[model samples]
Target: MDLKLQKFLESTDFIRAVKVTVAAATPVILFSYLNLFSIGFTVALGALFTFSSDIPGNLRHRVNGMLASNLIATGSTVVISLATINPWIFYPVLISLVFFLSMIAVYGQRATLVSFSGLLAMSLSFSHSYTGWALLQHAGLMISGGLFYLCISMIFYYIRPYRYAELRMAECIVLTSKYLKLRGTLWDIRADRNKITEELLSLQIELNETHEKLRETLIKNRTKGGSSNQNRRLLIAHIELVEILELAMATSFDHNKLHHTFQEHPYVLNAYKHLAYNLAALLNELGQSIENRKKYTGKHRPFQDLEAFRKAIDRYEKQTHTSGRPTADEVLVLINMFNYVEKQAEKIKVVEYTFTHALHTQEPKHKDKELEKLLTPVHYNPITITQNLSFSSTIFRHSLRLTLTVLAGFLIGNILPIQNTYWILLTIVVIMRPGYGLTKQRSVHRTIGTLAGGIIAFGIISVVHNSTVLGILAMTCMVLGFSFIQRNYSIGATFITLYVIFVYGMLTPDIQDVILFRIADTLIGTALAFTANHFLWPSWEFLSLPTFLENSIKATRDYIREISVFYNRKGEVPLPYRIARKHAFIEIGNLMASFQRMTQEPKSRQKQLGQYYALVVLNHTLLTSAASMGSFIQSRKTTKASEAFNAITGAIINNLENAMELLKEEKQNIPVDKETKEMLKLRFTELKEIRKKEILESGGTQNENFRLKMEEGQLIIEHLIGLTNLSENIVKAVKDIRERQ
Candidate 1:
């Protein structure tokens, strides 16, 4: 099957869309048959809003979120419906409600979704003509509908508890597969390193998000009684997938440097690239099998490829010795690259084994608090909201911006003599986000989708006026709209517009008026949103870049410290080390996302973009090197921590610390002694000579352990040196940016 089609068919989005559509359609169908279409419409609206909070999670939180959403949406509808009794009462009530509802987003993603439901309810309340007892009954039906949808969610979850987690794991594998293919391209010297770096960082950000959600689903479930055979297997596969990402990240190299040195050794590079491509192919196949719920039958011969790749490097090492070109650094790089590939191959095999064989081996369980730290924190306290009431809070500022923009939109709608004036408020509520870049992007997408949907819906209504056919089309659009909302917002908007038009066509005689008003109101609302976000307290990415960079540096430093300790006491990867690794990746992802957002903003808002880009690249490389060093130490049997190792690692850690300090405009005094630097340089030279001698002596006929020890020492020293240099460069970049500021 085609992968795109397969993704859609097997995706959680598709399943959730089916559930959401059913939740919405059930009430409408039943009530319309009984001639209570208005009540059914209200119920369907309630179900739709409540289902928005049904994000993937453990059973408890998922239910709690939906319950909260139902209560908020129901309460908002009742309050706003009654507040519309007078203009003075309506104005203040609407403004305060929208602001407070938007402010609730400070709690977290689930809260944000729940908050959106309340805001949406309040906005839609403006369209209602009911009053008093009728309004209360409408609210009652809404609560019933929300509860019904909650039951559906619970039923689906209990029927297939691990389905979401399994799908997420499959997604992780697929992302890692794509990442591997991109990583492979780095071996090609002529490839655009800058473009690839940007793409790789973007992919890492997506992977980090997926990994976090999976942690919430899989780890949280296991701790709360989800340790069945299937859960164990999926957990093991998830662990392997994370290790594969680390291994893939570690495989990154300074391609320019490697190309400069190995200009004559293109074949060796091709060998590495080919092996990487094959590994990616294997991962792709593995992900497909996982998605299809089938055991991974071994198909690709990765071992043979590994053997051939290793021999190719060996042949090159021999050639370097005969030529006496002094390319020892480049040769060691090739060896380390080979070692990184070997680690990934071993991890992939473990994942395959976990899938193919009966799962008997149990991975160690994390304590509750430890597992909690892996997932995104959710705050429910009122104090959390109070703390964010200040203007300094981005959410607070966004709330104000949203409130003011909505006020302007409302006034314009009232003055323009347009029917269904609430359409303007609806557009504003849907299009505006906390960040300017996203608001701008969404405004454009909403405008385009509304226009296109209007045109398409107009054509459909022109030819086919049958109400039954239109109802089916509306249901299908609702399904598509829910499915694509998170995956692709523009497409989601298009389908949602189609659904709205079809429904309004059934409700009113003037189908063309509905379509025209929707488009015009969207344009007006999006323009107001865009203008408000730009002129109001816009959350510029540059202002937050320093914190992101500092966090990444600190995480990277802690990770290097863990690696240093492991060098002295080599064993299984400690929980602390894993935590540090996770923090490092997450922070790096945050930084990348910030930089990407900055790129989308106005050029004038892009402060020191070039310097920030340099820092991003150097920081990325620094963390990659740290991961490589840590991975090597954990996987290999090697000598204890040498003094030279301490000297290099100490310098690297100090450099990172200094960079963080520079970001904070604090004085930095850490410095390595001249003698220590000279000693480290001499020690590295001695290690390289020993490694070369071991390789030449082995010549396909010597002690494997001895050769392996020499190789480990050589690679470890090189990684330490490269990391130190990257850290120093990062400090310089930070200093430059600080000076400019």
Candidate 2:
């Protein structure tokens, strides 16, 4: 019951590890049963390498991708096997092939899988003597083993094709629920708001990632056109999740209100915390329901704390006169804020119910426009071979780094005094990454895992003499190791080490010989990887911050331009604008991630660390503000009376451009209208009367859309005001950092 061990057991990755373990073992088990144990080593390795490409995608895409991987692995192994006897001719050919494929990985994830798997196949397939036909036959076995894995993935897909997507979406719900609980801490002035902000940003990044995955799932299903009911239900549930996040961000709570009076008013703190916990409980159950794919139990009991929260808010309002601190409108804002919390908390049950109990109701056309967009496949241009070859790109550096390290490992592994030298090469491929910090962390984890796994494997082999049972154990270790590899590298490494030990033990009975040599090979390979990553075209976060920041600003500018286009004329919010928004969010997320990585490095390497914090926080705020504009613009009434107001969008866009240059510590002159803020305020005042008049003329009553427009519009205006100040702060922050440098 150790906390860390328990956490590992509880992880979803553990379940995935179990699945991968079986899938990887399938080929070995089959070859052994077929009395082909000699080729099982080569075949299982081929299958395990193919597992690298077994990423999440739709059924057709997944099957096709795996098939292509098998083909490449087969061809690469045949070539490597045939050429090994003539190193003068084959060695350079092999190195060139590795570099080319490694470069091809710049295209994307799928490309990387194909290229890297091929590299693995080639490196591991070398043999001293073999007829061309004999090499073909062994290569055929390896190819068949990979195909065997395809069957495993296809079977699981048929069982429940959407299970992976469901699990991912469920995780999103669970995370959002936890974040809501964290936000509920905002009411307590005693909370570390800075730490909370950091956590909130982290959650935002997670949600952004989930959004992309879910979008891909929706697109994949839509193209296939099967089981519309479930897909639609899942899509609708996802949309509800989006709204929940938007509402969570929409709260304009006065942090200063609690600053001076949090101690004086325990009721305020308790009520907010009470609601936060209630929300957390509700969403947690909803996550479980989605995961289980069964009837939602509606576990949190809606409005369980509503009455008490209401009373607390009322009490605070009544005592407002005594403190003379909070204005009347501020109290109303808190009251209004409660209404949002209530509605959003209640939405969990409603959304969950929609999944099971079909509800047919009329909604605005814009209601499902987002779902439509999510269903459409994303437009992307793969990296051309030419672009990938460019030395300036990160992809090129990674490709070069990997190619050299692999070649070095290949040479050292061949020259070493070891029986199973391929283990050394395998460790190198699995442990090294594009980033120095990441590679270092992985090497440490791999070393620890190997020693522990070696001990475990040694103990098992010492007791068990039967090769059949030992083979099964080795296969099991393969499954567990591959599963946890990405999730917990050390654990995965440990299991992988055991797998190597037992797998070879089954082939040849010298346990001590295999274990000692495998450990030494691993040590040698990992050290080579470490040395190569540091010395070869090293790209650190701090060094590239300027480029990343500039790209982020450009993306932000595009997003703002798209928003303006939406304002000028709109028809369900153009797809281009939505795509722009997506890229904007993604790029900023990347920037924040890079800055986080920078913080983990040595102090001398991250000299601009302070400026990075300021810049990143402002970047986040800018995105949120644009998001607010998006939420409101869909319903806001724009007319010729305020056509001139679109000019303000131009002004803001100019400011963003200026900020981009300023972020690079470059001097630039961009005129800013000192009257821009005042002009927008005056225009908003004019538009307010016009909006109210239209609302009255249309129905003489405030509809939900109108209410949303009113609330969201004010939020948009406030956020814009915040954006201008944040822009000014960013300029000063960059200037100060430059001076210090």
Q: Pick the candidate with the highest TM-score.
A: 1
lDDT of 1 by residue, 1-741 (tens): 876787787789888998888988999999899998878888888898899789898778899999999999999988887777787798899889999999989988888999988988877887876697898888888898899899888888889888888888888888999999998887775789789888999999999999988888877778887478887787778878888998878765777877777778787877777778988988888888888877677678788889988999888888977887665556667777788888888888888777778976665664545655666666688999999998768899999999999899989998996787788888889989988899988998888888888999999999988899999999999889878887888898899999999988888889998888888888998899999999999888888788888998898899899889878887777778888899999999999998899999999999999999999999998898888878888777787777767777887787787788777745543354678567667877776776677667665523567556666867776787788678878977887787788
The estimated TM-scores of all candidates read: 0.92, 0.86
Best-performing candidate as measured by lDDT: 1
Q: What's each prediction's clash count?
A: 0, 1
RMSD of 1: 3.2
Per-residue lDDT of model 2, residues 1-741, tens digit only: 664565455454665555556656665566678987567656666666666777776666667667878888777777776677786878687777777767766666776787778877766765334566787777777777787777766776678767777777788889888778887877665789889888887787888788777877765575455436666667667767876776676454567665565567777767767777787777877786676655676656557677677888778766876676644445545555576667676666667676658756534445354445554253235546675576677778877887788788877777766676676777777777777788889989989998898888888888998988887777778767866887788998898888878877877867888888878988988998888878898767887786777777778779878877887776676778767777777777778778877876667778778778888887777766676566556544533324534655666677777767665645644444668767767766765665566556554223555554445444545655665566566656655665676
Worst-scoring 10-residue span by lDDT in model 2: 635-644
